[model samples]
Target: MNATAVTVFHRPPDAESFEAWLDWMGETAFAAEGFVECCRAVSDDPALEPGFSVTFRSEALVNEFLDSAARSRVLAEGEALGIQRKSSDLVIVEGELPPPGVGVFHHSVADGKAADFVAAEAELVTLSATFPGFEGVALFCRGDTGRWFSVLRFRTAQHLSDWMRSEQRAAALPALRAELTEDFSVVAHTTPFGSTLRTVDGRTRVTPTWKIAMLVLLVLYPTVMTLSRFLGPVLDENGAPPWLAMWLSQIVSVALMSYILSPAVAACFRRWLDPVDGAGWRISALGAAIVVVLYALTLLLFATVKWLHYWDYNR
Candidate 1:
């Protein structure tokens, strides 16, 4: 696609209204003269809002659509939903975007210097593709704001990181900058998986804290129960004080949760935990229900294995 029209909408207090507007605007956008494909994503940070990016194979056709009188007519309906069209420069968008990883670079190439800029970018793209896990890259000219968007995709975060931090890229920077009016900005797609949450250029958002709390409890409860049944007695019989036994058992619980179970459970239900994954009411309900069922099953196991119950021991 030669051009991409990127528009971010303000998220309403409720998802319903915003979604309805999305549906309507979505149809209107598709009906545009030069529609190629539309890609939509939410920011890692909830405070930033979500947006739709439509790509057109031909810039001239898209430009015609943008300037059409019909463009204002379609947007008038969104006014009721408090949607306002404000012009903001697409200067730099640095944040985690999703699954593998995609780094987006916005370059302000000076007028009449497109050829030189593309040569510089093409060299970087060719070099980047040789790196392990390199997938592909796309270059788009955002005629609306005279910005060039270079998107590079990799098969994994590690691959993207290697290319970004490689000495080769560092050395190539001066020549790349030589062709641009201003320094380019870049960042990629990501949502932290589980407790492995980390920020990339100040853009990683951890899965909701409460959700993480829930996953911890899921792993922690059974850990404590099992430890109390087995380890507690061994310590107690060995003349350890009651307080000391309890404290030791707690240490094992923390260790397992920190190094093992938390990451495990987080991996299992990562979709629900991630806000960017668009886990709606149904996914949330399903996840909670599954956890509750697991809780019941664990309780049943403890209830059935009577001899293992600490309270009933020696009875």
Candidate 2:
């Protein structure tokens, strides 16, 4: 089967209406003949331009979709909604579908070791193909930056994880590390079927583990403690069983963490979470201090409330 990628740029007048239309277009594409998959992302760096990357089973189907009345009608609506079409292109891909889970590994190779790194990368690719779920590998390098990007496709997330944590990969780590200015980085975007990892705008935005852990603790501790202290008694008063009350509290805590707390914390710490190159220790230290202060305040507030309740009970 042939695959084609289409990229279109447009400026939408109304954000809500534009998103609604985009959703409709996605459903329409899914129903089209020879549809494979379509992925859309609003550019994080730019506010106005949104992008879509779609794949089809054949070039004929892609042309058919372009010529269809449905596409014309959508275009008309987009025009009425003040969406100006910037440009569109169809790229024909000459290969089979990539594996379900794809990862783009970005490596900053040491100077003068580009050839050595390429040789090692070839051996690594050969070694990776022996792994159970390996599908394909593609290598790329930017002439300006001298940085390397390798895209590896695997059958599933589990299979990808297995290869990542495998003993063979571990054995090759030492040699790989020697030729790198910094440790390699990975950026992954997940889909229903699997996941894809690609650099966005020539850079990967991976928050460090320590920063993530700090942010999670900052949100999680307060969420769990607030639910346990205040909502626990309410659940008991409503005749909930002990186990049921605990379960309910956990459910609420998880919901808040997933939907609200985590995103908010990440936004608040975005700069420190994704620091620029050569950033000093002061930024990291300040983030840690903020989390420590939050923890201290939470503890003090809970302690004061507990002591007041104890005094009232004794009286």
| Clash number for each model | 5, 0
The reply for model 1, stretches above 4 Å from the true place, is 1-193, 196-204
> What RMSD does model 1 have?
18.4
The CA lDDT at 168 in model 1 is 87
Reference-based TM-score of each model: 0.41, 0.40
Report how far residue 280 has shifted in candidate 2, in Å: 4.5
Tell me the lDDT of model 2 at 218.
77
Pairs in steric clash, model 1: 96-190, 97-189, 97-190, 98-189, 98-190
Tens digits of per-residue lDDT, candidate 2, 184-264, equal 866433221111223332343344567677777778877887777678778877999989998999999988887777866
Model 2, residue 246: C-alpha shift (Å): 0.8
Task: Give candidate 1's whole-model lDDT.
Answer: 0.64
Compose the digit string of candidate 1's lDDT tens values, residues 9-61: 55555567766776766576688876775554333333223555666666566
lDDT of each: 0.64, 0.64
